[model samples]
Target: MLADAEKNGPKPAPLIEAFRRTWGRMIIGIGAALLGVGGFFLMTTFIISYGTDELGIDKSVMLNATVIGSVVEIVVLVVAGRIADRIGAWTVCAIGGLVTMAVAFPAFWLVDTGKPALVYLGVGLGICALSIPYAPIGAVVSGMFPEAFRYSAVAMSYNLAGVVAGFVPLLATSLTGAANGASWGAALLLMVIAACTAAGSFASGSLMRRERAARPAGDRVEVAV
Candidate 1:
């Protein structure tokens, strides 16, 4: 099986050529990655801190929520990927982004209520929202580039986004503190980030469609080849 797969695998494209052909789409992918990944990290961080310090939730409860949320995320991720494959990755991601943005404020509001069940519900909803965009992001990024440069372009975009996302925890903490322990400030920031991700996914999808439209039928086949 390994030998057969290796023999049939696609050859890697020259990186320089791939970058030249897909640079614009790569840029859009990076932007989407930054916002989407950053928002996810920020929300997780806020939940941990805010739940413990402000809401006085028990540590065991938070841990249980984390475990359950992880399961929900994995399930949602698979379902989201299947949905994206049937319709379109960008459409799925855009819809996910909108859901995430819409839920940000309410999720925090629920947590602040200091009710255990509501807190768990809020965290679960947030995880589900994050999973929607997270699941289809890889497909969307890969589709932005030709097969030859696909791996390199996708890695670069995702890694760069990871770097940006690394700062989100600190930023969320600082913003929340600045607002005098108000979670709204952090929630608002997350909403903006999620919105940016949605816009980026929408734009990337539009660009991909335009590129396809501009190509001659024969050229499109050749390019894919």
Candidate 2:
């Protein structure tokens, strides 16, 4: 019967074994997380709109916030990498996402004041806090596998997430009703973005935890080389 063939299908060759044993579930979880990362960039468009229309910030303030935020993101990521060994990747990234969302409120609030200068500090911090944990996510994915399959599995998950992250902005804009609410609505929509990140992060951490628990406590298998 077809059911019998499906159950007793030809065994995969060694080359394909790696694929067969691949962590498809884990990869999917991270790819979803990447959607939010891509979404973060999408929010930038709204950010610009908020600064100019709501906050009445001059072009210079917006420019400065962006430049400063980039610089800080680089610095903080370096620091985050060093501490990852102690805390584990999921913990660090989850915390990073939370902190990023926590600070986003005030960062966007400056739009109400219409003074872009007031936002530089918050934006810089927001970027760093939000972005630093992404580096650890790839490592987390790699850790789930034996050495042999680690490379492809890890790369697949991380790259897919990046691709998803690219579309986040457009998604956010549409969700927030960019045309209808304009500046004030854009600010409010940031909360939705934060919610997405929180949900993604929660699912990622929980799934990793489940995987970790599934591994035999005394039978550690190094990632497939």
Candidate 3:
């Protein structure tokens, strides 16, 4: 399938042109990226500061918990990828987002308890939830665009998400402060991101159908491939 795509793919066009041609799917792809990748930033990256600075967990303890969560994430990603392969990427993505949204508040509440075991549990759960969509999102976005500029579209969405996700730690900190030491601020942030991810993931299927309907029959074959 990959070889066939490479052989029959359309000539690469400007990134902007690719986006212009499929703006609806592009927007959905970007929304999916923002939440899927950005949720990871909240779970893994912002977690350290959220633990040590705000929750006052020992830095070493937080680091150890993070390591545990990372291990769990590794396992979950593989499992989720396999599940996505069997059940469908968008289905996995949507399920992941909903789980994350449902768990965000309670996970943060567990972390706020300052118990080491609870900390590990909270972090591990958060990482595992976030990793589900993270596993299948590359396939999701790649499938959103035609071969003509699939690479460009995927790069743009992920990179743009990366750029915004880079600021997530700062945003989490600011929100935490604004809430006057409440963990709900950061939790709300995660829930909001997860909501977007779930919504976008479900919407992507229909968007892909629309894109296929608009494409030439030959070009449409690449989408399924």
Top model by TM-score, which number?
A: 3
- Each prediction's total of clashing residue pairs, residues at least 3 apart in sequence or on different chains, is 0, 13, 0
Cα TM-score per model: 0.83, 0.68, 0.87
User: Number of the top candidate by lDDT?
Assistant: 3
Ten-residue segment with the worst summed lDDT in candidate 3? 216-225
On lDDT, the stronger of 2 and 3 is 3
Cα lDDT of candidate 2 equals: 0.58
Between the candidate structures 1 and 2, which one is better when assessed by TM-score? 1
In model 2, the runs with Cα more than 4 Å from the true position are 1-24, 27-36, 39-46, 53-56, 176-179, 182-225
- For model 2, state the Cα shift of residue 142 in Å: 1.6
| Candidate 3 error regions (>4 Å) | 1-13, 211-225
What overall lDDT, based on C-alpha atoms, would model 3 receive against the true structure? Answer: 0.82
Q: CA lDDT, every prediction?
A: 0.77, 0.58, 0.82
Candidate 3: deviation at residue 70, Å?
Answer: 0.8
How many steric clashes does model 1 contain?
0
lDDT order, best first, reads 3, 1, 2
Candidate 3, residue 81: lDDT: 90
